[model samples]
Target chain A: MSSNTDFVLSIEDLTVSFDGFKAVDKLNLYVDKNEIRVVIGPNGAGKTTVLDLICGKTRATSGSIKFKDLELTRMSEHQIVRAGVGRKFQNPSIYENLTVFENLEISYPKGRSVFGALAFKRTAEVVARVEEIAREIMLDEFLGTEAGLLSHGQKQWLEIGMLLIQDPELLMLDEPVAGMSARERELTGQLLRRICTNRSVLVIEHDMEFVKNIAHKVTVLHQGKILKEGSMEMVQSDPKVIEVYLGH
Target chain B: MQVAMNKLFGGREGLVGLAILAALIFIIMPLTFDIFRLNLVGKYLTYAFVAIGLVLCWGYGGILSLGQGMFFGLGGYCMAMFLKLESSSPESTKIQSTPGIPDFMDWNQLTALPWFWEPFHSLSFSLVAVIAVPCIFAFIISVAMFKRRVGGVYFAIITQAIALILTILIIGQQGYTGGINGITDLRTLKGWDIRTDEAKYVLYFLNGALLIGCILVGRLIITSKLGRLLLAMRDREDRVRFSGYDVSSFKVFVFCVGAMMSAIGGAMFTLQVGFMSPSFVGIVPSIEMVIFAAVGGRMSLIGAVYGALIVNFAKTFFSESFPALWLFLMGGLFIAVVMLFPNGLAGIYTSYIKPRIDAWIQGRRGGGNLTPTVPAEPQDPVSPRTAERTPASAASRSLAAGIQSEPSRS
Candidate 1:
C-alpha cells in the first residue's frame, strides 16, 4: 500500500471509538484502481463504520484516510463526495419524495449551486443520461414512478444508480443487496462487475456467494479488526475467518 | 388548450387558484367591499405573505420557524419608522417639546431622534431597509443554526424564543419602539395622507398586485429543480449532503428567501393598517401565521393565500358578531386542521376535486388507458364539501399530475 501509487485509497491506523467501544480500531486498508473490494463481517463488526469514516460521515479518533492524494478525514461529507467518493447507506436512502428520473438527475455532476439548481433544466442530454442510468439499474419503465412506491429491491438498485450518475472514481455501498431477491442479487452482481471495470467499489456484504462472484479481493472484519485479507477461496480456507463469519 | 391552461395557471389546480385570486382582487373586492373592509382584506393578505413563506420553509424544507413574527415585525417597523418620521414634520409636531421628533419620543422625554431612526428619514433607504434588514437578520440566524446542523423542533424552539426576546425588547424600550402603542400615528408616506379613503383604495390595489407578484415568485421557486431538491432534502437530508451539495447553504438560502417574503407583507401591513404594534410581533401571531399556512394547504402557494383570507375573515366575523366565541373557534380550527386535514384545503381539493376533474377531462378525451398507480385499495370516505386528506393522496396526485400525463408521448 505504501509503494503502490496505483492505489486509489489508503487508510493508515484509522480508529473510531463510540463511548469507549472502539467501533473501527486501528484499521488499515487499501483499494487499488479498478479493484472491487468487499468487507464481510457479522453485525456490529464495524464494516459500516469504516465506510462512514471514509465518507466523512463519522469522524476518526486519530487516523488518516487518504483518497488519491487528498486527505478525506479532514474534509466534509460534501467535499469528500466532490473529491470522487460516493457512499450509499445500509438502508435504501434515495429521495422517496422525488421520481426515479429526478433522483438520478439530481445526482448528476453539474449545476450544484443554489442559482444553478434554480435554472437547472431537464435538457435533452439530461433526459438521455437519466434514461441510460434508469436502464442500467433495471428501472427504465419505472422512471416516472415515485421512488417511495418502488419495491424494496428496486429502491436499492435506484440508490446504486444515483451513485453511478456521478461517475465517481470510488463508490462505497453498505448492504447493497440485503433485502434483494436471488434474481435481484444476480442482476446486482452483474451490475457490480460492469461498474468495477472503470471504477473502484468498496462494499460491505454478508452473502458469501455474492461476495465470491463480485469481489476481486475480500477482507473479513471481526471485532473492529481485520481477520483475513485475500481471495474468497483463500479467506474461506482460513480457520479464523471461518470461525467468526461462517460460524452459523 | 393545454398551453393556454399552463400559461394561465402554471398547472391544473394552480389555474383555478389564479383565476379566483384575480377575480377577488380585480373585480369582486373592488366592487363589493367598502374601503374599510377592503383595507381589512389587505391586512389579511399581509399574513398570507408569512403563510406562503411558511409553506416553503415548513412544508418543503421541513423547517418550522415559529418566530416568523420577528422578521414580520422587523419589516413593519422599518416602514413604520419612515412613515412615523415623515408624519412628524416640524409643523405637525410643534406642540411636542421636540418639534421635529416623533410624539412618542417627546412623551418618553427624548429631544432628538435615535441613531437607528435617522436612516429612515430617506425614503429610498427605508424602502431598501424594509426588505434588506429582515433578510440580513434571517441570513445570520440561518447560517449560525444550519451550519451547526441544528434543526427540527430545536430550531423551531430557538426561533420562538427569539420572537419572545424581540417583543420584550420593543416593549421595554418605550422611548424608541413606542412601547405598547408601537410606532403609531403613521399618517403619511411622502406627504400623501394614508388615512383618506382614496389613499386606502390605492394602497389596497397596490398591495394586491404585489401579493400576486410574490405568489408568482413562490410558484417559480417551487417548480424549479431547486424546489424539487427542497422536497428531497426534507425527506432525506443525508442523501442530499452525500450528493456533493452543501446542505446548510441550501437551508440558509431558503430561510432567507422566506424571511424576505414575510418582510414584504410586513411593509404592506404598515401601509394599509396605518400602524405597527408589538401585538403582531410576538409568539401568538407568529404561530397563528403558521396555522394559516397549515390550514391553506402547506404545499400550495395559492392555498396559502386562501388560508390567510379565510382564517382572518372568520376571526373578524366571529369577534364582531359572536365576540366571546372567537377564541374557542380559533382553537378548534387549529385542532381540527391538525387532526383531520393534515394537508389543509389544498390537500382536500387535490384528493377529492382534482381527481374528479381529471376523470372528466379523460372522459372527454375518450379515456381507455388509465392504469391504477397504487395497489387497489378502497377509497377513504370523503365528504364532497370538505377536504379529504390521506397522506399518500397528495403525493400520488402530484405524481399523477406531473408524470402520468407525459408518459404517453414517450
Candidate 2:
C-alpha cells in the first residue's frame, strides 16, 4: 500500500442502493493520478454504479468518496464537475442539434457564461486548443458537422474530447467503446493511452480485450461487492474472476 | 435558379430566406395593393412581431404560451389612451367643438384621468409602457410558475385563463376601458394624419424595419449557447437541471423578451388600425397568436413570419368569403398542416428540396453510384487511457452475450 500515498481518489466502503436493493456494496477502491483503472463486473454487478457514485449521479448511501482530499459524497453533480471530475454517460449526452464545434465550445468552462459565450472574442490560443483536440481525435474533417449526424463511435470520441476540453482532473467514462467499430476501437485505445499521461481515468468497460489493452490495473465486482483487484493479467487468472466469467 | 430556390427554402437558411421574403413584402405589397390592403398588411407585420416572441418562448423555452395577445392588448391600450386624450382634449381644435372627455371617461363622470393613465399621456411614456408593462406581467407570471416547475398543459391553461380574465375586466370597466365598443376614432399621431395614404406607407415601412430587427435579434440568440441549452431542455430537462444551469431563470428571461415583443406588436397594431378593443385581448386572439407560430413551423424564425402571413391571410379570406365556416377552416388547416407537415412550411421545403439537390449533385458526379452516408462520430474522441476494466471478470463473462466477444483478445 506504499503506492497509495500517490492515490488521487480514495473510496472507503461506499455503498449505493436503489430502494432496498444494494447496487454497490461497501466498495473500496483507490486510483492514483495518471493511472487508468478499469472496473469490470456482470450486468448487475455495479461497475457502472460505482462510476455513477463517483460522478455524483447515484449518491452513495453510507461510504465516503474523496477526490484530491475533497469529500465528493456531499457535492452536487455539477459541483463535482466543477471540482475537476468529468463524466461521460453510457448514452452520449451531447447537444445533438448543434454543430460539433459548438458542442466542444459548450464544454469549455469559459463559454458557460451568458455574456462571455456570446460576446467573448475567440482567442487564438482557445482556437488552437479546440483544433488540436479535434485533430488528435481525427475529427478535424467533421468539426463543422452537426453532432446529431455522428455515428455511435464518433459520438463516444466527441464526448471524450469534450471532457478533455473541460480539463477535468478526474475523468470517468461508462462503456466508452460499447458501440464503436473495430477500427475505431483501436484508434480509441491509442487516444486513451495519450490521455492517461495527463489525467486520472476510470473507465467502466465490459470488453476484456480492450481492458487488457488499456487498463493498468483491474477491479472485479460480483453481486455488489469487489471480487478482486490487481493487475489485469493477475485478476484475469484469479479463480473467482474465472468463475464469474465462465460460471459453474 | 435551382440553387437559389434551395437556398430560399432550405431549413437552416432561416436568416437568408426571411430577409429576402421580408424585403419583398415591404417593397411589393405597397405597389400591388391599395391603401386599405397596405394598411392591413402593416398590421399583419405587427402581429408577426408577436409571433417572433412566441417563437422564442414556446419554440425554444418549451412554454406553450397561449396568451401573447394579452400583451399586445396592453401595449395597444397604452398607446390608445395617449391618442384618445390628445384628440378629445377641450384645448384641441381637431373637431369643430370639444368632444368633451372621452366617452368612456365621461361615462365614469369623476374623471381627471386615472393616475395610471396620466403617465401614458406622453409619447415617451406610452412607448416605455409598451415594453415595461408586458415585461412586468411576464416576469411576475414566469417567476411564479417556473419557480414551482409548473409546466405542460397547466402553463397553457393558466395563461389562457389570464387572457380571458383580462378581456372581461377590460370589458366590464366601461368607463375606464371604453367597454366592449373599445377605443377608436384616433385621427393623428403626433400631428401626422393617420388617415393619409403617405402615413399608411410610413407605418408599413416602420413595421417592416421592426420585423427585420426582431428577426436579427432572434437569429443571434438562437445561434448562441443559450439557444442550445434551450433546445437541450426540450430533449432532456433533468440533464440540464443537473448540468448546473438555473433552468427557471432562462425560462423567465425568454418569456419577458417574448412578452415585450408582443407588446411592441400591440403598439404597432394600434397605430396602423386606429383602434383597440376587448376583442383583441380575448382568448380567441390569444389562441390565434399561438396558431400563427405553430402553423409557420414552431421552431424556425422564418416559419413564424410565414405562419403570421398564411394564417392571417386565411383568416381574412375565409372570414370575408365564407364567414360561417371560417373557424372550421382554421381548425382544419391546423389539423392538416400538423399532420402532413409537422415542421410546417419550412419543414416541407427542407425535406423536399435541399436533400434532393444534394443527392442530385452527388449522383451527377458519381454517375448513378449510391453514395454511402456515414454518420461521423463527434469530433471529441474518448481517450482509451480512461477505459476502466470490465468488472464482469472471467467468471461473469459467460452471462453477458452481446458485449462479451468484444476486445477481450486485444
Candidate 3:
C-alpha cells in the first residue's frame, strides 16, 4: 500500500470476470521504469485483459493497478491516458480519415479538452513535434497521406507514432507485429527498442523472434495466471511455459 | 491574411462556394421572386438552419439526431407565444371570460397566463429562451445517452421517440400549448406588425443573414482542430478516446450546437410564417430535415441549404400539379439520391462538375499559350502507374515505397 514504487506499473491480485468467468484471475505483474516487458501466451491466456486493466479499458472486479502512484482502476479511459499511459489496440486503430500529420498532431498531448481543441492553434511547436515523431516512425515523407491508405505495417507504425507523441510514462501494445512482413517486423523491433529508452513498454506478442529481439523480459500466462517470468532465455526454457504455450 | 481567410472558410474553393450561395440567397432569389415566393423561400431557408446543424452533427460527428424538429418547435413556439400574447391583450380579448390571458387559455377556462408563458411577454427573454431551452434539453438528452455510449441507430431511434413525445405533449396540452393547431394568429412583435409586407421582407433578409452567420460559425469549427477531431471520432471513436479526449463531451457539445441552430430556424419560422404548429415538431418533419442534409451532401454546409431549398421547391412544384402523387415522388427522390448519389448533390458537384470546370479552365489557359500544355501527372516517384491510380491510393503507394526503402536493422 506504499505510495512510493520504483516500478512504473504494479498490479497485485488483479481479477476481471465476465459473468463469473474470470478472464484474469489474481494476476500479480510488475513493470519497471524504462523496461520492455513482453507478455506471450496461448490465445485465451488473458494477455490482452491484463493490458486492458492497466489502461482502464476493462474494469477489474477485484485488485489494485498502481501506475506510478495513481490507482488506474478508478479512472476513466481518457483520464488514464492523460495520466501518461498509452495503449495500442490489437488491430491498427489509426484514424483512417485523417492525414498522418493530423493523426500525430491529434495525439500531441496538448489541447486535449473540448474547448482546448476548439481554440487549439497549429503552432510551429506542434508541427515540429509532429514532424519529429513522424520521422521516428519513418513516416516523415508520408505526412500528408491519409492513414487508411498506408500498408498494414505502416499503419502499425503510425499508431506507435501516435502513442510516441503523447510521451506516456507507460506504453502498452497488443500484437504490434501481427500482420507485418519480415522487413516491417525487423523495423518495428528497432523502433520499439529506440522508443523504450525513457519509458516502460508492455507488449503482447505471439512472434517469438520479434519478442527475442525487443523484449527485456518475458511473462508467460496460462488460464489468467503467470506460469513463468524471467529473462527471454529463462522464460523460453521454463518447462511449464514450454508445456502450456511453446510446446505446441 | 490570405492564408487566414482560407483557413477560416476552408480554403479558396470553400470561400467561392459560400460566395455563390450568398449571391443566390441575398441577390438572385430576392430579385427574381415576388413577395409571396420570397416569403416562401425565406421559410425554406429557416429549415436550412436545421440542415446546416445536421452537417456538423450527423455528417461530421456521426451522431444522427431525428428530433431536430423538436428543438425547432421549441424555438417557434417560444416566438409564437410572445407574438400571441402581444396580440391577445385585454382589449382584443374583452369578449372572452378572461380578458388578459391568451385566447386559447380563455376558451379552455384557465384564468391567468401559465407561469412558463409569463416570461414570453418580454421579447428579450423569449428570444433567449428560443435558443437556451432547446440547448438545455439537448444537453440533458446527450448527457444521458452519449455518456452511456448509446449511439448510431439507437440514438437516432431515441431522438425520433423524443420528437414524437414532444408532439403528443403539445397536442395534449390544448390550453397551454394552443393544442394541435399550435400557437397561431400571431399579430405583432413589440408593436411592429410582423404580418406586414415590409416586415416579411426584413425578416427574410435577417433569416438569410443569420443562416450565413451560422454557416460561418460551422466553417470555423470544421476548420479547427476540433473539426478534425469530430471526423476522427466519427470513424474511430475508441482511437480518439485513447488519445485522451472525452468523446461524450464533444458529442454533447455538437448536439447542443445543432439544437441551438434548429431553434434559431424555428424562431424565424414563427416570425415569417406567422404561426407555430406540432406538424413541424414531430418525427416526419424531423426526418424531412435530415433528408435536406443528406440530399445537399451532409458534409457540405452550403449544400445543405441548397438541399433544403431544392427539396422544398420540388415539393411545392409537385404538390401543386400532382397533389396525389407528391408524397410518392418525394419518397422516390430520396431513394434515388441515396442509391445514385450517396454523397448527395454536393458530392455530385465535387466528384463530377468541379473537376470538369477545373479541366475546362486549364484548357482555356493552355489554348492561350503558344506551347501545347500537358496535364501534370501526380508527383509520385515510387509508383510510375500513379497516373491511373486514384489520388488517395497514389499518395499511399508513395508511402509504401518510403517504408520499403527503410534500412533494415542488424
TM-score of model 2 relative to the true fold? Answer: 0.76
Candidate 1, A1-248: lDDT as tens digits: 45345689999888999999999989899899999999998888999999999999999998888898888989999999998899989999998766677789889978788999887766778878888898989888777556766778889999999999999999998989898889989999998888777899999999888999999999999989998999999999999877887866
The alpha-carbon RMSD values of the candidates against the true structure, listed in the order shown, are 5.1, 9.2, 4.3
* TM-score result, candidate 1: 0.92
lDDT of 1 by residue, B1-410 (tens): 65334433476556666878889987898899887788899899999999989988888888999999999999999999999999999999899988999999999999999999999999999999999999999999999999999999999999999999999999999999999899988998888989999998898888888888888887777766677788889989999999999999889988998899999999999999989999998999998999899999888788889999999999988899999898788889988998998889987877677667777776667666574423112222222112212224546545454553422221
Better of 2 and 3 by DockQ: 3
Interface quality of candidate 1 as DockQ: 0.52
Off by over 4 Å in 1: A1-4, B1-9, B322-324, B358-394, B398-410
List clashing residue pairs in candidate 3: none
Model 1's alpha-carbon lDDT is 0.86
Q: Which parts of model 3 are misplaced by more than 4 Å? A: A1-4, B368-410
Off by over 4 Å in 2: A1-31, A42-80, A120-124, A216-248, B1-19, B58-63, B84-115, B140-198, B225-251, B350-410
Query: What Cα-based lDDT does every candidate model obtain?
Result: 0.86, 0.76, 0.88
iRMSD, per candidate, in listed order: 9.1, 9.0, 6.5
Please give the DockQ score of every candidate, comma-separated: 0.52, 0.12, 0.56
List, in the given order, the native-contact fraction of each candidate.
Answer: 0.59, 0.15, 0.65
